[model samples]
Target: MTPRISALLAGLLVLTACSAGSTPAPSPTSSPAASPTAVQPASGPAITISGMTFTSPSAVAPGATITVTNSDSVEHSVTADTGNAFDVEVDGKGTATFTAPTQPGTYPYHCTYHPSMHGQLIVG
Candidate 1:
């Protein structure tokens, strides 16, 4: 065969071989990153730990139970920043509660494990 005709035949063979294969796979779709759940409003006296932050209602009644939940992957605890007012520990994906102080004032608190994690409890 002529050099030109041979090249044309080789190109046709390559095209035929490629088309003989199975159907192509579908492209994968990207998924959204997981997000932490919203902090549930404190029904009465409760403190929640989500996204590595402590959250509480504006004010809680004295002598009431204060619930704390740690939703992060690491352990965290609630410790009174002053006077040793209250100390509670909640493991990773765990829940715990402590009784509110009797005095009516703002009680500052923090995570003993994480100094940057802090919050305040208003007793009134």
Candidate 2:
């Protein structure tokens, strides 16, 4: 083959190989799922209420069930200042579940064991 024709063929082959090895662009839907607003019972995230530190979503929507897990090494109680939104004593590494009030208002809660451990739940 002529030198010119051979050079052209080599260039074409190199271009084809480069294009074939290129990765396809990702689609918009390929991204990870959006995280939940509040933690779930089993598979979902958890709010830690122990000691004097209160973790996770400090406030949640009204009528929403919040799961409070005690990761500390002692028992803890969740009591609302108003009526009993939910009062349960969870052992160490245990969890308690309670639903927020149907009305939208600010509810202050604290741990019976630890008076200093306090948090507020704002339902709207």
Candidate 3:
């Protein structure tokens, strides 16, 4: 009876050991690297003031650079009622650039050559 019991215990231990060894270890291929992330930087908007009137955008963005292009044959100037003004005396197909004020306000401006050619820029 002792010999039979010892034999059964040995068989159980051997089976357990075999099962543990047979189980496969996790493979490196099964795991993957963490996904990469994309980051974008914050930037200010742009405004293009052209033609007999403001082109591309009629309104001006605060703290943005306002670029004025004179496509007409006559010379034009940007004069604001609040004393914030810029002169753009360019020949036909010429271009000029000016920086808009950071302060938020309403500015009414017009071309000195043609008073009727008026426009308004609202900056916030």
Candidate 4:
């Protein structure tokens, strides 16, 4: 065989071998299944912090995801008043998230940056 033809055949074989051994890309309509673990973040409602105040959302489910949106010009945080329930810091005009406690209750949280700024999270 000609030198050029031999080179072309070898390149085609390499490509075929690579594609045959590799896994196909996932389809856009399909999603990877996740194994359940002890800790998994579940998305829920959202909390908006504007005008140096915390606007708590409606009642949330226990062990749900709590997202914080800080629209102020300064950074803020959502910190539990008592035990370490959940703490998430968000920058000015930024957002952050935290996992809610498994036990349902009224959780009072405050901004670690601004002590006067406080909010309550109602979980059912």
Candidate 5:
């Protein structure tokens, strides 16, 4: 084959090999499966924090005893961004509880120490 044809065939073979070896990305779905430790609504619901993650559903009812257990090596807090309605802190490997807001609204919370750690508490 000519020099140009040989180069084109080599490029095609490389592209084919790359695509065959690559993994296809996961498809978008309507909903994702809940984690094993995700908590459900009840009289007194509890959530665990590990690796700076709030391991629970984002929504909960009002007037519930929302417990927060911190299993990390560093201290973390869940302080409400709305008027300081509910703020709770748990030391390393410690646990704390706070009452949910009586009003029906979304309360955005974050860790005071680490601003990157945040989640919303939807009270309805």
Candidate 6:
């Protein structure tokens, strides 16, 4: 075959091979970084841990049972920064609880596992 004709035939063969048994492209998918997270509003006495972060409510009822939720892949804790007012440990994708101090004031807290995670709760 001629040089030009040979080149054309090789290109046609490659195109035919590429089209044979070809499958459609897959669609885009979303990533579920956190699943079934129980995050309450800021006004409520709920604490949520996501991406090693602590999301705490503004204030809670005095001596109320505060809920602590963990959505990360590891365990976490909400411990009082000053005194033994409250301490709660939550497992991965789990929940725990602690009692709020009856004194009407801001109680700072931090995560025992992650020192960078910190927050505060007001009991009034």
Reference-based TM-score of each model:
0.64, 0.58, 0.51, 0.64, 0.61, 0.63
Q: Write the per-residue lDDT of candidate 2 for residues 71-92, one digit (tens) a residue.
A: 8888887778668775767778
Model 2 per-residue lDDT at 33: 47
Tell me the tens digit of each residue's lDDT in model 5 across 1-124: 9999999999999999989978877666523444466566444577788988877656778887888889998999999876868888899999899998889888888889998888888888
* Cα error, candidate 2, residue 53 (Å): 1.7
- Residue 76, model 2, lDDT: 83
How high a TM-score does candidate 2 get? 0.58
For residue 14, model 2's alpha carbon misses the true position, in angstroms, by 28
What are the per-residue Cα lDDT tens digits for candidate 1 across 1-124? 9999999999999999998996977445523233255355556577889998988878988888888878897899999998878999999998888999999999999999998999999999
Q: What is the lDDT of residue 76 in candidate 1?
A: 95
Q: Where is model 3 more than 4 Å wrong at Cα?
A: 1-51, 56-58
Candidate 5 backbone collisions, by pair = none
Question: How high is the CA lDDT of each candidate model?
Answer: 0.86, 0.74, 0.64, 0.88, 0.83, 0.86
Please give, for residues 6-111, the per-residue lDDT of candidate 6 as tens digits. 9999999999999997997744563343435646544447888999998888788899888888999899999999989998889999988888998999999999
For all candidates, what are the clash counts?
0, 0, 0, 0, 0, 0
Q: Lowest lDDT 10-mer window, candidate 4?
A: 30-39
lDDT (C-alpha) at residue 5 in model 5: 100
Distance from true location, Cα of 48 in model 6, Å: 0.8
**Pick by lDDT: 1 or 5, better one:** 1
Per-residue lDDT of 64 in model 6: 88
What does candidate 3's lDDT look like per residue over 2-78, in tens digits?
99999999999999998986868767665244324534543343333455665435556676776666767667776
